[model samples]
Target: AGLSEAGLDLPPMTAEQRRASLELWQRRKAAVLYSVANNLATVAKDHAAAARVYGQLLTLDPGNSERICAALGRLSMQVGDLQSARHHLGRCAQSAPAERRDFYAAQLAVTSADWATAQRLFRSALDSNPGNMLAANNLAVICLYTGQLREAIRLLESLLERQPKLAIHEGLVFNLCTMYDLESSKSVGKKTRLLETVARHRGDNFDVAAFKF
Candidate 1:
């Protein structure tokens, strides 16, 4: 599709480049435009435009519609657009692979504050694939919200221990520390231990502020 030649495969670093990519996308409607859309959302931080491009991709690349829908769903969530998140994530779950359907469905449940349904879906996703850190993290959140504090703590801690790479996950660390704060008055010691553990695993790349100590 001449994508590399047009620089559409690379991140557009400036507004002029982004405009050029958008113009090309409007004219081409190629599935390769996903790279441009991803860079627009991730690098340029223009989520609305990225969502628009992904919407177009749903038609241009029906074979990857579920993936595009998932991207749009996450973008909607990041922008606090719960209505759109529910719509897109539900679409994703409808056609996504069996192994991935529950995660998208769980994300859809989150948009409506259906914690019980979300908990069930996320737990199912994690059970099916223990490497699904997002599913595990969300399930832990539902548990915490449902007043199962110890269960939440155990889930996150055990997952982190099993997958040390999760030490760099900001949301997981923050939520775990929040649980520690709620579970006991002696939370600083726990947070300190968490910080040490993460530091040991990730060196200096992990943000210290995520622990909220």
Candidate 2:
């Protein structure tokens, strides 16, 4: 990967300047390549290799340890290693900066269906980044589960207005609009539009297979 970044010759500069630029570029490329390799290795079911790359990333940049640790925790959760996920996420939650820790902790609790913890963490995340749409959306999710339909609709609608690109948000919106409206399941046209929006934004992180239109 370093060799590849070095291959991209920029327009002529002083020999020393060119050499320094290339050296720095190669280091950046190597970091990116290592991260991508880690992602692919995890996808290929090569957990050991992926773990090594993640560990390397930790050494390469201590400032980014929080996110890398979150990634490791998520992967651990996926592989049925809940104990490991909790262990690492707990460390990250304890020591990470508030901006990152709040969201990461929120995600950990949400994925486990711990609505109470998720609510608390999402509120914390929102306090740090008041305009964080995902955190607001997640808080709405907690409201939905807790049978606060009117409030959930308010939050979900607000999230959609701000960030319309996430398909998963569209799915959540579809559920909320159709189920939680004052009219409940009676607003046929809005329901149709929601389903259509879901299809339009379909691909990645959302499986519309069960949505029969």
Cα lDDT of model 1 by residue, 117-213, tens digit: 9999999999999978888888998898898999999999989889877888877898999899899988999898888888877888876888887
Q: Residue 206 in model 2: shift from native, Å?
A: 11
Window of ten residues with lowest summed lDDT in model 2 = 204-213
Structural similarity to truth (TM-score) of each candidate: 0.74, 0.58
Off by over 4 Å in 1: 1-46, 56-64
Q: What lDDT, from 0 to 1, does candidate 1 have? A: 0.85
lDDT value for candidate 2?
Answer: 0.69
**lDDT (CA) per prediction:** 0.85, 0.69
Candidate 2, pairs of clashing residues: none
- Residue-by-residue lDDT tens digits, candidate 2, 1-213: 323344654565788886887678757965885767566664577765676677777777667777678777767776777777887788788988768688778867866779889888898887887668767877877877888777777776665656555435544664555544553555657656656666666644554433333
